[model samples]
Target: MRITPDTLEIGSTQKRNKNETLETFLKRITHVSLVGKAIVLMENLNFCKNLNVLYLYDNKITYITGLECCRNLTRLYLQNNAIEEITGLDVGLDRLNVLHLHNNRIRRITGLHLLPSLEHLKLDNQRLDPGEQLEFDGECLLALASSLRYLTLTNNHIKDISPLEKLKSLESLDLAVNSIQDVEPLESLLSACSYLSNVNVLGNPVANAGPPVKLRQRLILASPTLTCLNEKDIPQVERMFVENMRHAQRSRRSAKDHNHTRDQTTSLGVSGTAGVATPACQEEKPFPHLPPFASQYRDLMLSQLTKNTATERRLSDSNLHISPRKVASAAEALHRD
Candidate 1:
């Protein structure tokens, strides 16, 4: 059914169709839903100052306006719309606690700095390009950092999330189906947001980098306080076991590298010592008292005597031999000649 500003009670129950004035309607109604009506603009809602919950989702609304009088609003659902930007929400949403803006054309996260009481925010399924990262106004988010607890930005083409480190009170975060390729930024969240326990990164590149079991173990190791990952609860025993295993692996690798380096150093040292020792041992002179020329001549005479002995052996085998005295006499005669 179509519901316009003038015919606001078209789809409402019979109690709200009792021909009541706008003031009476505003005073009695606490919740309203004008969904699936192709609504382009929000009007005639200024009298709804007492409204606590409003659902205007699945419409063609291009902007957020006409809600400045809803100061008592706590929950707002504006998802599945054509909203290109977030504005006009700084007026009367101080009491707003929950906001759902999923499936919209929003590219930048803004218009939330004044919402000091905001707790849960969902902005998933935005109209973003491939490889396009979600941008944020750090100052705006920082203003609400303390009050924000649950944040869902899934499937928004987001890659960098360093700005979220300031959300110290954040408890649950959903960042699935994005382009986050690194888990280091998330590690910071563990320390910054002491209360953070649940995290969803199911469709990111980091999640697909390894097997599911290993990924879970790595994430658990990264954040020791994490109790849930990708909607699965992580038991304390599993976390402890993964941490211990990682520690043991690191120790083994370190020891192996150390031993390898030591072995290489020892082998080099032994080879160097052996090379020097062989030369030093051989350099020790056996005949230090002998003159340099006399030692050389003595070594030559011994070599000649040894050659004569071998020649005599060969001559005897042929039935011919020379006596030692004859050999000596021939040597002296040759020397004289």
Candidate 2:
């Protein structure tokens, strides 16, 4: 049966007056909630001209159709269904900001490039054949580069998330319980998507391969914004640990550069007297290209904090279970006002 105007009037949370008929109530309604009602077809929803959000999940809906007129629709929750493909969404969903299509049978992702305002897209846990991974459309990834942020692509048998490099504005990524064996793509994402803060790759082989603490530290340092890994919250001590390491690296680099410059000046020295010598070197203005995360990391990088490797030592104590409190205590004295 079609999602008729009467069905919508009944499903909507907007209270219809006793005197109001189904036909009159449907015209003014802005949202519809038709969950687990044994709905078989997605038809007759165009009557709600001012429709903004649609919650039509947990039903027997097979195919996505009949949403061609929802131009103002911003959020669509159609998860936990038998939907086999991603269709009927690109027609007039330009303003759609959120789309939840997880726990379905959609094998390939398409028609998402049309959503210019999409920010959160969840396409996880797809029902696929054994050993089959969910596929993506390349154009869709490029279109989601600027606006798309939070993404959850879990349990799709996906071994690679290299396409996520294009989603520059992504803040949180959940790739849990997948077949991802290599984290090089995730490592690259730290630079590509500087806004990425929370990542959940808990059940992946890469997360279980190496030392968990070191892996956490390496990823945190790479992005400077990552505060959560495998569902564990990263505290201030771990962040301070990275800052100290960064400072140590910068110091070593500065000293090495200074010594190299001094050697170059010594090589170009000119003898003036028996014990006096003159060296010449050129001086100019400085220009440095900073990463996108520099300003975004201000809340993380504190200026008053002195650099120390105490937290680093604490992390070395356990490769598996990292205690942020213990790590923080190692350098607690330095943080006192």
Candidate 3:
């Protein structure tokens, strides 16, 4: 019944007691590191019943094997290896919480539903081509949806994330440097996964569509419950302000469009004006009995009108002077004198 936690380092030499059996070694070691040994197959690991953490990264392991008997395994690091498919992990490692399989050849996500306690699953840069998208098995994801919370799929060429809609318990998700082009899937995620508050979608096509402020506003509006986006916290007041600004902008744009359409219609109706005097034309005509000065200053007024047409003149009280008619009368009097 005496249990002692100890770490065993099996270096490149793979040296061990010549007479020690695998069962005896397994019963003694709680952590093991066989990193960078060019090991291909995962053998001699079944006897590690007390093994809680195993690091086998930077090797040539083609498939996931060994450790089938390590029921107490909690953390397994198999990153930077040659794991093409995610298999061979069964119910034995049910207690596994952190599993790092990044830099491998895993094209499809599978064989992970067996780990009911898995929380963090890292699978970034899984040997995918420049534009190739990573695929996932729906059933496998649904199985992990309840327990898996922190998941990283960076640089995986993932475009569609509909399969993650069932991850209601997921809290933090990293999809940075991916090929995602739409934010609709993330909106669905926010609606489905209530606990998902932190999300990273940087370096994606969707994030580059607009300015940072506009993109952040769109994301916040899409997911009001989000507390963190692209590593930045979304304060409550900021969220409210962004939403209000978006609403106001939409209203202004709609009003401008409506006014423009109305003006176009009015212009079309008043196109032909040979005998028809439009209201605008009638309003500009001078009164008949304004004296001979009105006719004399008509050319000056027309010149002023032509100049004003190029730009809008802001009329203020400070700029007001004698009426145009009075000015015209004074000029005529001066000429007569």
Candidate 4:
């Protein structure tokens, strides 16, 4: 059987190899769009039976019905096809390991369990709107979970991925834009899959749910191998933590400020006594009146009292308003006083 010329069409490289066998033709050709008619001709030639790899992406095929004849097929590239359903794939292709169905219209995954050897599966652009159905869509995912090691379901409508725990062998999983919020799923992943090393939840609510530092800490504790986490979207948590520390420092500052004010007030009172003392005799009667020192003492006492009162009022304010700078300033002020 001779592989057709139309099936080998690729850019200016569309020249046909008339002498090649059907199997050689399919194997040599790559990056060609296999439309429905070309696929039918290939199916009729029975040439795909011995084929180990097939590139049928960017095609007009609506279903996976044509690939049943290629039983020995190990890698199938059917990306950018018009296929809507994922059923009826059980066939002679038991050796199939890598299936790239990216950019397909597949709404549901139904017949994926048949390929027990499947190691890496990409349904990234299927737009699977698994409404209400939280976990794997029935047995298909269950079978995959049993053998699948790497899976990418990015750019889909998948919401609750807690079901991924079923994939005991999964090592790398990409669920970037899902609607999951809680970090509870991490626990399940850690418990079920001991080898899980990487997880990308960058654009989801879970990323923005908590403090980045704290979240990073918790994730590190959960999986020491977890090298990356994307919780930076939660700016509020970061801000809140900063605000809390600022408030604490402010409080300490106010306390210091109050103490400083108190010391200044006491010093002023003692200094004022210097001018009011008698001539080392009859001092008990009290010196006549206010000297410059006494005036200075009075002004100093009033300023100290005012500062102390202001500091107390500020300390009583909400802890949210305090800042680190204020605390340091207060400490310095207390030292000077």
Sorted by lDDT (best first), the order is 2, 1, 3, 4
Model 4 deviation from the true structure expressed as Cα RMSD, one decimal place: 16.4
Candidates in order have lDDT scores of 0.78, 0.78, 0.77, 0.62
Q: What is the TM-score of each candidate against the true structure?
A: 0.72, 0.72, 0.67, 0.56
RMSD of each: 14.1, 22.6, 11.8, 16.4
Q: Which residue pairs come into collision in candidate 1?
A: none
**Candidate 4 residue spans exceeding 4 A from truth:** 1-45, 128-135, 228-337
Tens digits of lDDT, candidate 4, 92-194: 5678889888787776666787889999888776644456222356677788877788888776766667667778888777777767677777666666776
Clashes of 4: 2
| Total backbone collisions, model 2 | 0
Steric clash pairs (candidate 3): none
The TM-score measured for candidate 1 stands at 0.72
Q: By the TM-score metric, which is better: model 1 or model 4?
A: 1
How many residue pairs clash (N, CA or C atoms closer than 3 angstroms) in each of the candidate models, in the order given? 0, 0, 0, 2
Query: Model 1: residues >4 Å from true position, as ranges?
Result: 1-6, 9-21, 129-131, 250-337
Clashes of 1: 0
